[model samples]
Target chain A: MPYVNVKVAGNLTEDQKRKIVEGITELLQDVAGKPPESTYVVIDEVNRENWGKGGKLLSDKEK
Target chain B: MPYVNVKVAGNLTEDQKRKIVEGITELLQDVAGKPPESTYVVIDEVNRENWGKGGKLLSDKEK
Candidate 1:
């Protein structure tokens, strides 16, 4: 079983989550010959305040 | 920057999550020499219905 975990710096819509799950399953099936039925996709939506990049929290970044 | 994403088949307590984050950070620091400040840990709690193991959905497993 292939378990795919995706982390992002904010919440995502249900549709977005659905697409991600589907896309990852397809990709694994195509590239790694993994079966879609056994592929698991989990999305973790991290708060901006908790996510850091370049030594800075995502929340502190200016838009 | 090292990003860690943990996926589990069910919900976890706040304490458990905290410990996981800390443990992962420490492991990365000790083993990979990654700095704690630049390391990010995200935990994903997946529904049993969505997770499969041994060609069977986790939800379908009998207790």
Candidate 2:
């Protein structure tokens, strides 16, 4: 079983999450010969305050 | 930067999640030479109904 976890920088809509779960499942099945039913995809939405890049929190970065 | 996403079969307590995050951060630093400050650990708690194993959903398995 392949469990794929995706970390996104911000929140996503339900539709977006659904598409991700579906797309990743299909990709794993196509590339790795895994079954869609056995594949698991979880998306973790991270707030900018908790995410850092280049030693700086994303929240503090210039927009 | 190393981003680690942990997928668990069930929910975890905040303390357990914290330990996991800290342990994984240290492991990445030790093995990959990644900085703890740049390491991000996101734990995804999957419901039994969503997690499938052996072609069967965990929720349907016999307890």
Candidate 3:
């Protein structure tokens, strides 16, 4: 089983996560031919300041 | 750049995806600590019928 984990900025409803997870599971099944039970997906959120790109945090870069 | 893609069952808002992306970026930065620009994440959605587990589609198993 393949466990797909997504890490991102915090703040989302369970419904939103569910939809995203379900969508991904389906895609993997078709492309990778992995069964739903054979695959697991998890999302992880974090602080914007902790994320940096090109020496600047994501939140700062977006500003 | 390392592009993280998540394939799941369809249906999620842009905002929700954004949040998920941001959260994941932060985690990689902390754990793997990769620069935000050095990494990219994408979410792909699909139909439940396409996802199967234990010889049953996700939708069918859920029912």
In terms of DockQ, which candidate is strongest? 1
DockQ for candidate 1, C-alpha atoms:
0.13
Ranking by TM-score: 1, 2, 3
For model 1, the superposed segments whose C-alpha errors exceed 4 Å read A1-7, A10-44, A47-63
Overlapping backbone residue pairs in candidate 2 total 0
Q: Is the docking of candidate 3 incorrect, acceptable, medium or high quality?
A: incorrect
Residue-level lDDT of model 1, residues A5-39, one tens digit each, is 78788999999999999999999999999999999
TM-score of each: 0.55, 0.54, 0.49
Residue B13 displacement (Å), model 2: 0.4
TM-score of 1: 0.55
Q: Candidate 2: where is the Cα deviation over 4 Å?
A: A1-63
The alpha-carbon RMSD over the true interface for every model, in angstroms, is 5.2, 5.4, 10.2
The whole-model lDDT of each prediction reads 0.77, 0.76, 0.64
Clashes per candidate (backbone, < 3 Å): 0, 0, 19
- Residue A2 displacement (Å), model 2: 21
Candidate 1 CAPRI assessment class: incorrect
